[model samples]
Target: TGYGDDHTREIMRQELRERLIQAEREGRPLRVYCGYDPRTTDLHLGHTITMHKLRQFQEFGHHVIFLIGSFTSLIGDPDDVKAREILTPEKVAENAQTYKEQAFKILDPKKTEVRHNSEWLAELGFLDVIKLAQHFTVQQFLAREGFSNRLEDGNPIYLHEFFYPLMQGYDPIGLKADAQVGGQDQLFNLMAGRQLMQKLGVQPQVVIAMGESLPGTDGIEKMSKSKGNHIALLSEPGQMYTSLMKLPDFAMPLYFKLLLGWSQEDVDDMMVRINRGEVEPQEVKAGMALDITTIFHGREAALQGREFSRKAMQEGGIPDDIAEHVILSDTPLVDLLVVTGLCKSKGDAKRQIQGGGVRRDSDKVTDFDEIVRVTDLPTVLQY
Candidate 1:
């Protein structure tokens, strides 16, 4: 996706084909890898796009490395406009632990090689960094959109931010990678690896393949956790199904193509049917939601999730088996929402009430500060 044009994509395709032929002649599987920084504990659907690519390589009998950026994540990726908050080593470790487990949902655990970049990045000393930095010019870094935006806005671009590319570039050398897969935004870092390999006397024949970035629920912006527009890989089947069902109609075709692996022609035909009134968009969306949810939570759970969503929507009531939570009397309504996991925080609960999205049974919750006294016991709470 980051190839920019058809010409560039064709070049990469030709290069990959040539590399495969060469690897076969030498009687060795090609080494392919994609790096992920464990900035958060849970990975969203956006993160799985590259993993699906890695899975394709696995099926082709290529060696795949799921590289975790243990060290580089401390500085974070300079992909954002502003500098990122540095994470503690403890927090990084905690987040890294869950990444592999979640990634296994898409990648083959037996064929995948899990590696931490800290093995080599942490070993680089002062002199080693200086030698690595000498290869790149400051103008090159400034040319990047993220850095340039920060520069034009007079924002501080920390010195450590520049080192991210250098560290990421060094990862291929450490693993002796033959190819790397990443999203389009990581083109700069992927190219950096190719440049470093050539400069450092390692094999410079690294094929860089970048996939298209997935848009969030908004159907416009990139799917992100901070934006609250992401569906986590580990989300419960019901939650995942509900989330996918809520996607804007325009976003369905892309989800069909990317997540469901439907051909572009198929997607266009489905849209055509909807436009002609031959098929309903909601039915199509429900199928998409079910198929995608099944990928992570299995068919049975996905079926149940579909049923749950149907009851909640068409019937305007929750399922009979929905989880039950007991609350004490005199509990503040806002506090009750958070404790019962209905909302993320007290502030979120209050916002829901103010927005008229919260309810106690059939009655709307109009006041955020309302108290649940003994008389309110056994009442159904909904949001």
Candidate 2:
């Protein structure tokens, strides 16, 4: 969510209001779009912020384009300090396969028009690119934060990286979009679209830049898959619930607002109650976890996830439905941990054991070389 100041936000709001009236008079739905680059195989909760905005448009009978950045993903977004590794067309295609399925978890599939940017971007010839490039100056590109930061740090900014914004800007031209939604970090790119539309003699699209960024589980950095702080849309219900429950109490209000769409006033009231000792933060967090989990995994699964969390964390007991692994003979504890998916590897199991995090039947396993015999088959293991 990147609307810089209150004045700008107010202007955008007014413009949108007028545009809505104009569209209604024309008896046509406003064409709104948001693009997503399938850089990863799965979309995380952070990716859904703009999606939720798109859903609102769909609900209002507006036309929504779920544009996939098939061409742009090649260079990646130049929002990073350093140039991103280029992805092959094959890799980008593979990742794009599941994007729509995951997106449908939040979006109404019937109301959404899915398009790949490659349809238009790949058709642009060299002459077309040159004509597009004429609209912006090198100084303007250099003025962007990512490019400027890299320049100051003496980092190499690839010439191709400059073309990313141009390609993205051309999207609105191709789609004739009325409005675009994106994260605040994408403000510059969204502005590029508006500027390009004006120069090309087309009506500029309204930019609905989201002003809030979801913090990761760390409750500090923005939620990112690369940072290992993301909760993936495809995550198991129990895993998703546990991950949200791990967030710091300070991060709960934002999560409630962004994920649950709670109003600022409601979030403030909830925080006041928590501060006044009217309710336990854990209880509130549990409710949030359950509600959010229910969004993706259904109510029954979310309830089961809550039960699993309560058993493992609060009650210090295992869920009755926890996976059972039958062992016919004694096995190395480290080996068992890996086989049962308790640890990533033997080294991870050993480290967990060394840290006194590995437990059997509620007793901490201090030895890395400990064995799990047939006698311990019925015992519960906790990490």
Candidate 3:
């Protein structure tokens, strides 16, 4: 499975070199796994960091299990969040069906072993749960970042929330995973797997922690669908492409490094170019968009995205393939723009003109007070 071209070999060599030193000290390729809960209906860019880590393991000839958190998702994995919202089993299963297909966009399906925790977690009896819980103490659970934050802030900490780690820890033991992959936010739970495996007399799984999460278009919190900041995995290629284009210039290089699989050296070089102002930020963002779209779509689609972006930007119009708002009438330009869902508010639309951010058919708008006469232009003007 590790056999590939020169670049793949180099990537494998680098990752394996780092991982081997942290392994069980034998010469065998270690089993590596990462788990994902079917909380949201679609995977976002945030989900792919761990998926990329799993891909790295696959490239290094290690056994990789892409575990689905069907069982624990029902209880809700409240590790980083303040509250856990319950999900029905059917909803979780239905959501899981799309996950593997989305994951296959980046991961090698043949090298991945897909398993659902419900297959084992659901069959556990009262005594089984007790045995699993025996490995950790209340103090230990409370000490975790999520629980600790909630407790300190007077948020409700449900009893079921404590079972999340116990169930997750049981996964490595069940699969005999040599390493568990998780984002930095999941460090507490990932470490719990080590403790639980040691307590259960199984080999402790080594932890490969992913970097901090990518924020959404809003560029504040983690990219989540509920926050309206996420670019959904299942979004149209053009939409996903445009969303990447919207990221602030500062976030572009990080996206390239963590999401686009660029080498650290390449990322550092880009940073240097950026600091020198030798490369405009939009060029970097365009490169990131191309790389990411190429992963989900292909070279042709990524090129199409670039071309579409060029046309949209040059003409001050939305991409042709993107959903178009057919204005029933030639509405007022400002109203038409806001109705198209481009501007956040009427005030924002006005501000854009006042702040020189608004453009009208390739012409910069200088007057926010000017009433857009439908008769002036028969077609609607878009942002």
lDDT of each: 0.84, 0.87, 0.75
For every candidate in turn, the CA RMSD to the true structure comes to: 6.9, 6.9, 10.1
Which candidate would rank higher by lDDT, 1 or 2? Answer: 2
Model 1 lDDT-worst window of ten: 320-329
Worst ten in a row by lDDT for model 2: 315-324
- The TM-score-based order of candidates, best leading, equals 1, 2, 3
lDDT of 3 by residue, 297-319 (tens): 78886676666556665653544
Residue 317's C-alpha lDDT in candidate 3? 55
Score residue 371 of candidate 3 by CA lDDT: 59
User: What's the residue-level lDDT of 147 in candidate 1?
Assistant: 89
Give the per-residue lDDT digits (tens) of candidate 1, residues 1-383.
23356776677788888889999999999999999898887789988888998999899999999999998888888855678898988899999887998899999999999999999999999999999999888988888888888899889999989999899999999898889888888878888888888898887645555556788988889898878898888776767887898899999988998898999999999999999999999999999999999999789878876765665556446554344444434788888789889899998998899999997865899987788875444445788
Residue ranges of candidate 2 with Cα displaced over 4 Å: 1-3, 312-383
List TM-scores for all candidates, in order: 0.83, 0.83, 0.75
Instruction: Provide the lDDT at 93 for model 2.
Output: 98
- Sequence-dependent TM-score of model 3: 0.75
